[model samples]
Target: MKILITNDDGIYSPGIAALAKIAAAFGEVRIVAPDVEQSSMGHAITHSRPLSLKKSPIAFDGKEAYRVNGTPADCVALGLHIYPDTEVVLSGINMGPNLGNSMWHSGTLAAAKQAVLLGITGIALSTPVGKTEPDFNAFADYVKEALEVIFENKKLGLYNVNFPPQPKGLRWTRQSVRLYDGKVVPALDPMARKHYWITVTPLEQAEEGTDRWAVEHDFVSITPLRLDLTNEDELKKQLDSAVELNKQL
Candidate 1:
């Protein structure tokens, strides 16, 4: 299997390197990622300017790695264009966990989403970070195990996988749906200029059997995702109500 690997944490991030090394065990791996960090960029594509891809300054063992001057989504778009035969696109081993509601704007997930959009299997992998960077070596085995299980499902086109620092096992999970408390914390920069940091705090705890819950309990969480965003139940309800109103009228 030909695999194209990309991430939002830039080309030099260790996360992508670690992922490339493990992914090689599965098939041929190539890396194309942003030259600099583009975290939280979502599925953005550059329209105003032409993007560029250059050989990466850092090496990923002997894998063919390149850096792009674009978003994570852009990298995948270009990578697939370059390696048209790529069978799978793996994004991340991100520096931070992309779980629950955070997936909406996660560039790590966006890279994988781009692959699926182009009719290829896309998988996004991530893990939590601490005061220091995560020890990817410790969870290398789990990463391999998760990929093995995910590959068995040929119909699952897109997936989001999160691993704990130490995983006891793997669990197929659903995305956590919960409210969040958004806040903007005011602060002063080194230049004494006013600044604000927009952030969110979860309102409730993780529910059982969700991606968030699985990772919190030290299990690798694999959540299969789809491209459609339609709420079929709501659409059906509106259609039924409209039909009833027309009959009365």
Candidate 2:
């Protein structure tokens, strides 16, 4: 199995390095990631500008690695083009949590989504960060276990995985249909110039089997996701309403 590993965090980040080590045990691992952090960049591609891919010799335990000057999705796109026979695409070991609706804007998850769009199974792994530094070596075994399970079920399409700061076990979860309290705060710099900062505070509510609920309860949450966003019930309702309107006319 040829595996392509990537992350929203830069190629130099400890998170990617840790992920690469785990991936190396599986197959021929290729690490192609953003040269700089592209966190919360969504499922964006690099169609506007030419992408720059610089090969780094002996990077990530001597696995073939490259640094890309683009978003996480861009890295996956180029990685696939270069290594077309790649079986799996693994993104992150991200610096933060990508749970609930936050997955919509997470570059970590975006890389994985890109792979699925290209007709490959994609698995995105992330861990929450806090005041205490994460001991990745301690959780390496757990990550390997998670990857093995994902690999065993390759036809599952795209998956969004988020590990707790202190993970106890894994759970099959669903995406939370919850909203965050978003705000834009204006601040003044030293020069007294005003600038705005956009922020979102998550309202962590546990509803049994949701991704946020599992993560909040100290479990590794795995949510199988799909590219289709159709509202079948709504579509059926609208079709019925149209028929009624046509009869009236």
Worst 10 residues of 1 by lDDT: 149-158
Writing each residue's lDDT as its tens digit, candidate 1 over 118-234 gives 999999999999999999999999999999998998774999999999999999999998999999999999999999999988899999999999999999999999999999999
* Model 1 ranges off by over 4 Å: none
Please tell me which predicted candidate would have the highest TM-score against the true structure: 1
User: What is the lDDT, from 0 to 100, of the residue 92 in candidate 2?
Assistant: 89
For all predictions, the C-alpha RMSD in Å is: 0.9, 1.7
TM-score, predicted candidate 2 vs. hidden true structure: 0.94
TM-score of decoy 1: 0.98
Indicate which candidate wins on lDDT: 1
Q: In model 1, state the lDDT of residue 32.
A: 95
Please give each candidate's TM-score: 0.98, 0.94
Global lDDT of each model? Answer: 0.95, 0.89
Clashing pairs in 1: none
Model 2 lDDT per residue over 68-166, tens place: 999999999999999999999999889898988888899999999999999889999998888875778877888888887777884748998888767
Candidate 2 structure lDDT: 0.89
